[model samples]
Target: MMPLEPVVLSFGAVLLLGLGFGSGPCNIACLPYLGPVFVATGSGPRNAWRILLPFTAGRLTGYTLLGTGAGLLGLIVQEWIAAPWVRWLLGAATVVVALSLLWRRRHRGGGCVTDPASATPTRVAPPEIRMTNGVATGASPGATSGQAQALLPGGLFLMGAGMALNPCAPLTTVILAAATSGSASAGLLLGFGFGSGAVLVPTLVFALGVAHFGQQLTQHMNRWGSALEHASVGLLLLMGMGTALGWIAP
Candidate 1:
């Protein structure tokens, strides 16, 4: 049995870690994917929150599920991680990802440019029509509802959930290790805390982006995106090097 106080404390610590992970360019992993979907929906600013709410909800749900899984499989995961070679392999994989990101940045010019034409949504103002007894007197054919479903709660939720499900070795190890230290309940709580922390920065950022769709948001995404991406990747690379050197157990 896990000690209650220590488990709770560990959970709290992991939660802070989650927040740090989610707070930076890693948040891009969560935001960029969902942002384009919302833009494609053509719902415009009016439905911004409608889109954001579900995505956040889905992300949180995904985190909870990940935690539960980790806790339940704690022993197995720990055992697998016990092998020295596995740790080395993970360290190598981390380095590979960091190198890949760096290469991509160098070759592709850092995917930070938001096309001006694309920034302005193609959604036209809804046509004004007089209605009487459920009859439209001046219905215009300008409105397109083809992408309406994509703007729905379900679509947004799926987008957010998918992002949460994006593979992350560090997060997985964190979850599994924390789970191994305590009961499944503790693991779940730890993951939950981590997820909550992770969502904070991205949530605020995407929320602002959605609420105010214009040049400012686009500029920030394009200009600062590369810097943030590099910073995040650099941190990961350092961690990988540290792990490879056996400076840390993980």
Candidate 2:
């Protein structure tokens, strides 16, 4: 049995490591993957969590799984992640995400608009709104329309998971510590702490900031929404291609 003190210290260290890196390096690393998706989704501050929660959960799951593997298989887990096939799979997945986004943008017509002549801004009511008993009511966008609503959370989850799988220095450090810990439970604990620390701050602050800013930007620049949307799609395509072709490091 390992000494409890060492394990506790190790866990704390790994968590602190995550916290230390999360504000700067983690944000930088994660933004490339998350920023475009968040912006293009056009979610407001009120609903941003709809996308963030699942994505954060996916990352936590990925970290836990990686840590467990490290503890169970020692260093062998590292080799598996480093394998070319893994990169290829992630790359393919990225390409698919890009394509899906492209399709959604094309199909989602009648975006927010404003009239220069009118005192009050008027735009197309979201498809999610309905008239019930002659009373205007809003419904869950995904309640009846299944796939479209599910796509954001589901894709974001995959993106989060894929991002976690990419070996960041903080994650690598945690994995190594967990591997040396020699207990799956210990690894899981360390992984959870680290994952929680890494995401708790940035996920809330950075994502919410982006969501708020993005919504404002979209509302103000409604006329250019389509162009911005196209640009986002283009960015996704480039990221997908780069990931697949090894132009971007995994």
Enumerate clash totals for all models, in the order shown.
1, 0
Local distance difference test, each candidate: 0.51, 0.65
Tens digits of lDDT, candidate 2, 27-90 = 7766666677655656666767766887788778888898888778767777777766555655
The parts of candidate 1 lying over 4 Å away from their true place are 1-9, 42-46, 75-151, 214-250
Q: Score every model by TM-score.
A: 0.52, 0.81
Best by TM-score: 2
Residue 219, model 1: Cα distance from true site in angstroms? 16
> How big is the positional error of residue 8 in model 2, measured in Å on the Cα after superposition?
8.4
Residue 148 miss distance in model 2 (angstroms): 2.6
What is the Cα-based TM-score of model 2? 0.81
Model 1 lowest lDDT segment of ten? 125-134
